[model samples]
Target: MAPSLREGVSQARSFEFLRLGRQAPWLVLGLGLLLGPGAFPHRARAAPASGADPAALLEQGREAYEMLECPKAVASFRKVLAHPKATPAQRVEAYVGQAWCQVVEGNEALARETLQKALEIRPDYPVSPDLSPKLAAVLEAAQRDFRARAKVEIDLDVTARGAPPELGMRVRDPAGQVNEVLVRYRTDGEWREVAAHSEGASLWTARLEGAAAGTLPLYVETKNRYGFVSGREGTAESPVAVRVEPAAVSAALAPPAATGAASGTALTPLAWTAAGLAVATVGAGTFFGLKAKEEEARFNGDPSQFGSHDEALAVGRSAQRNATTATVLFVSAGVLAATSGLLFVVDGSHGPAGDAVEPGFAAAAMPLHGGGLFALAGRF
Candidate 1:
């Protein structure tokens, strides 16, 4: 068979490459250099269809968000996240973008979940309020939710202590059961958790037995208590250095503030009454909601549980009605509790005698998301 024109061109290119590689090694080296990693830096990268770098993908997401294309922006950010070598900062930015997408989709709970992942990477990470005032407003609500469920703060009474260290820790833990242990590095560079005795009060005491005069990492684990069971690990930013002479310990009569309530203010009598009603109403709503959901789940659970198809349908409709009532009650209670902040706005706490109101208190209802915090510096 006769060779085609394509084959002839391929053979010609191959012959030229071979002639250069053998007869002129320097030219071959030059050619290899020109065709190496740097020459096709962006070619055949992951997330091929995007045709943009991670930074560009992030920008595309931002522009899409501004244009109100929530799904497109989310997809772009997801592509950025899918990059195998994504940095923590890049991951955080992608998460924030994804969170904004959730907010746009009217899923505050999911949005809050997304932001929590970002905060896990950089604990004190803040969100920029000005980027999108509405979304930033959602972030404020999300942070409150985070603080309620999983905030972790550990305060030590002394960092430099004696041979046997008694580390007094005042933990503002929203996640359940704040567990701590002193971890020391062995001569072979392996960390072993040292046995420690602990006492609980407003301040929980963690006393390390026979711990030498050296630096040790104070490792803490936080667990989810109420809804789900999960955990995360955190380290003391500053390591503990046990010293020859223990540092002077200070004592105070006042008790430490509780987790998620450090900035609380005592309520007035009228405010107290309104707050009680709000709490009561929401509590009732939750009870009914859970009971109704249980019924719905059973109806959907197994076929044999039902006596008849019509009976199953009737049960389903009943559960639906119950759920509808729960929704109405939850909304009503949320409205009442949400507007309760207005009462605090005039709680006899004046700010600079005529400036803007700082409202010495902060509260958020699920829908309002009005009163938390936002920071541009929180951006990676």
Candidate 2:
């Protein structure tokens, strides 16, 4: 394979590795949960404190919990649990309150188990109790709701014509489940499903339709086999926004209508002019150089004839002058041709109407005209 192809593949692999490294923390967290919490370090229980006011701490914890202050409530509850004078009922309530605070802060599983421990401690704990009923409701809601996340990875293959003349997408869920993704493209104030989900590895391919292309917001939603729709997670990976830009759109869309058209027309003529100048320069130089060599050969062959010698000397001098003139013209033409060619390339790559046109065609054209005048003088 070519060096460029090798470099591209290496870059792609490096990017993939970096992305996976970033997601390593989430993977480890999931694996730890799957392996069971007992496999991890157990949270240390707060030791019993001597002569602490249990009622006051419970009230403080309740206030913190109501205010949605999870850390503060957890700290106050721990203090209440640690009090030696606290009854079994009060201790259970403290655990239950801590669990409720955890649920409010979005730690669902820990909250459920903490509530379970409270129930186990006091089986007669009233399910209809004000705080207990509210905690139960929160847990039930969490369980009933289907939480899901998704991410899209885009790989742009740059070609000679343009970068990613076509577009595609791949979507993956947290459970390592791949789904055939469809994208509804937004174009000219309207939305259409440009690409249908084909049988592939969660990869959907679509061709770019026009020269004016941008990032189209594609709404992607998927249903599982059980018909449960994935709820939107506000995280970066979920409902990934893919940005697609067609190559050289700005160049193609250059305006000031008349100027743009003139510049575009001028570009082709400039290219051909440069090419013609270069070929002419090279041919002129070569022809004059060969004639000078022939004149030198005749002078060397008959040096004995004084009259012929003077004539040959004049012929040699004239040939030398012609060669010198050709060399100067060749060099001048070459520089102008190269400059024009460079301008044409730059104008073609970017838009032709701005700073690009001013320096290249405008500024250099004057010097080029002067050079042509000098070449005409040399010809005379």
Candidate 3:
């Protein structure tokens, strides 16, 4: 090999070793962790106070875990961390609890990192004896794996369902183009990658999208300029399970039910009102129409009866009022009738053959505040 190439190879190996050196402490810790619970050489921190007990939260997380509600369990563990006066031991408990959940949720890398954090808080921390052997193994592997890589801080989104499943994940993203965050999702037995862009300081996000309202599995990773990848990886410890469900319609935002009938014959209130308005307007039109015709006859009966120009003008004015009133009522009747007809047709289409609304009687005389005759009967 040329001296220059040899020198380049040497430099590459040196960089690799240097990188491995930085990870050495975590590796040693991971090996010790492999010894299993009650074996670490650190003192036990006292449990939290009764008033600030984290045990309940731990139990809550545990129950969620057993039920395969990893997201809920993660939440409980987070609450433990947020507890007002959680002790170091309690904090460790929370960390471990979350790690356990992360493993089951297919975020094995995250689980590993969490366990490492717990170990930092208490090097001698032991696994809970109450944990099942299967879970113990998961925890064991996660801790062992953490030694292999450094982890970035992350927050996972676990919404049950919302518009496109409110994909909100917060993770530490270095502020540079050289490092890129990528989210990979597994669907239909295929893995696809999507770029996760920076949202804020150290926050990278990729909105999760689902197809056909189903479950999706996805994980986040970051690649540096050096081609080194670090981030959460799915393992038995963290099998990402996200359910994509149809978006719920809030009562406030729900679309109105069709005025049309499910069986094809139901009429909306508007449709019914339109029909009544058409009938009422038609009735008015008929009455006015007759009055107009009557006035016309009276005028033709004796044009000479008007003795002066003023008298003729007076008769003409009366005829004009009659004509105008009749014209308005007739126009209104045509419009309302058309509207009602359209409504009725639409309502009928929504109903099944047997569900069509039976003919209803026309508005029986509307009762006025004071006794009055709206209409005794229709002539036409």
Best by TM-score: 1
Candidate achieving higher TM-score, 1 or 3: 1
Estimate, for each residue in 1-380, the C-alpha lDDT of model 3 and write its tens digit.
55698899999999999999999868755633443233212334434323325766776665565455678878878988998877777787788767766655567677777887775555434555655565566666754554344345556554323564444456654322127677777766677678876776665556555533567777666665444454454533366775555664322233334444344444566787987888888888788778777777777677677788787777667877988897898898888888888876676544455444443322223232234323332111
Selected candidate, larger TM-score, 2 vs 3: 3
Q: Following a full C-alpha superposition, what root-mean-square deviation does model 3 have from the true structure?
A: 26.1
Give the lDDT ranking, best first: 3, 1, 2
Task: Kindly list the per-residue Cα lDDT of model 1 for residues 44-152, writing each as its tens digit.
Answer: 3334234567777876776676555778989988988898767767777788878867776778789878988766554445654334455666667767776666666
Model 2: per-residue Cα lDDT over 1-380, one tens digit each: 55698899999999999999999868765643432233111335444433458967776776565445669978988998888888766787798777776765668788766765554344324444323444556544433331212222333222111244344443445543233334444557665544434436655555545424545444544333323333221222333334554466423422223343444545667777877887887888788777778776766676765476568779778778877877887797788788777866755543444434332211111111113211111100
Per-model lDDT? 0.58, 0.54, 0.61
Predict model 1's lDDT versus the native.
0.58
Model 1 alpha-carbon drift over 4 Å, by segment: 1-52, 129-132, 158-160, 163-380
- Clash-forming residue pairs, model 2: none
Cα lDDT for residue 110, model 2? 80
